[model samples]
Target: MRRFLSLLVFLGLALAQGLSEVWKAVEVPGGICADGSPYRFYVSPGDPRRVVLDFQGGGACWDAATCSPESPTYRRRVEVQELLLAQGIYDRLSAANPFQGWTHIFVPYCTGDLHVGRATVDYGGFRVHHQGARNALAALEYLFRNHANPERVFVTGCSAGAYGAVFWADRVLATYRNAQVALCGDAGVGVRTEDFPGFRVWNPRLPELPGLSPDPEVYQVYLALSRAYPQGRFAQYTTLLDGTQVFFYGLMRGERLPSEATARAWAESALRAVTAPAQAENYTFYLAPGSQHCILPRPELYTLRVGEVAFLDWLRALAEGKTPPRVRP
Candidate 1:
């Protein structure tokens, strides 16, 4: 009976808060999932002057094996219930959340293309729509139309969504040209195998970045964005030995189950990727010690720390246009 009473009070407080009441589901006809399902994103009202365009991560697929529905590496559909019930950064009850009370646009990932593909590929007899770029653009178009002018906009994502955030921050800043835009890539670092070049299967419509290598990695995208948007603040967070990234790294190298060497190589590549853009004064990184894949959407967003600097505080500094020192464990 006491537990039930506590739940009632929590519900009453939630009702009074009204965060859940304002979540609007917006569907774009041009957007779609890997399975050709209709794609939709969610938006919740808050201080309209400030906004967060958060990309949802569920991993990625490059070739037929990983793209298979039976494969565990990637998600093929958007789960609305999961998004609506999410905690951590989305937890309005947490006053420590830097994004609390900010208008939120949740961009769901299901296309297995790191939110940059605009193609339909054939895997044996199966057809998968790698329309990530289309879906992301559609969601941004909505943001451009609805929240054109805001004081601040934080573009971020976890895992594959991290890659999404890195790729799309430029577009977001362009839309809100006057707004102070900050970007934080959660965990996805683009470390690909040169020999395989399998990611080409996605046929991503990359931004026409000048001076970028003919074939640029994810880090190059960050570098280009940092240079292009000099006024935008940017940062990245990653665990020293992120298991998910190691797995994907091996997959890119054609190893279904990554070996110890794969993890070592992944660590090296990920470190290089994050540090490559450190020359940009506007960019910094938070390197935690763990195998955790992502952090922004998890409770660790508030509790995790490296040395004396808490991850939450570091992120808050980035969001607030303050330069948080590069942290390494």
Candidate 2:
């Protein structure tokens, strides 16, 4: 009986040690969420020189109807404490994940601005704070101060977070001069340049890209990053019939809920945006069939294939500096 009790205690200690390696929620000093709560991020200790920064994905809102306290979109805010306890691809212990053991920084999304909004707007009697850009800058500053040198850095995100990742990739690369960087934006194909005015209120800190229009499309950001970092890698993944992107594009284009035909047209336009950069050697993409929204969070991430190429394998190749094919449906 004593032997069994001793063994049980030993097992308990082992389990606790393993759990300690998982992500822990850390509140950023002076950071604030859209709802006025304190902003926090999850950090799991690993190799300081190798890091994977993942931005949490939730829908975005720009106006009174979407940003109101009672709206459905407002409820999608990510709670960092809850996220630290959940197991997903970002978890270092996930056997299927390639990024295991890398220093993982999970940036939670709650500002409802795709991590780029900078203004506080009044919605009738209520005031909504759109300070995503400031929030991300705080987190990045924290990371840079602590991990002064990084050998390999990957910046990525899904859904709205994907836009955040792309928007911030150049800044991240600039901060770490010698680090080899790669960016993968999943399901963040945004609206056209004509619709840019709606988000222009956010006053995104866009990087300078020569020859592109003053108000370039969102996908154009990827191209600009590519030109800015010729030695770095860039990739995007999405379904050809992604209804989530279609809906957002339509809404930005003045349609509250787009018709099937209208949605298809917008999806096609998004496809063109991604493919244009894929034609460049440093940029690549994987566009599968169906109406699936995001990839990194799905179990299908392990099994989804574009032709004979598995999605996981493709991601692995990209991380290892191999140029994978630009897949299409």
The best candidate by TM-score is: 1
**Candidate achieving the largest lDDT:** 1
Tens digits of per-residue lDDT for model 1 on 76-166? 8876433545567878667888988998899989998889887899999788899999999988888888886889999999888898888
Error of 1 at 316 (Å): 0.7
Please identify model 1 stretches exceeding 4 Å from their true place.
Answer: 1-22, 81-85, 196-198
Worst 10 residues of 1 by lDDT: 79-88
- TM-scores for every candidate against the unseen true structure: 0.91, 0.88
lDDT string, candidate 2, 202-286, tens digits? 6665555566565666678888778877778899999987888887766666677878877778777877878887656789998
**Clashing pairs in model 1, backbone N/Cα/C closer than 3 A:** none
Q: lDDT (CA) for every model shown?
A: 0.84, 0.77
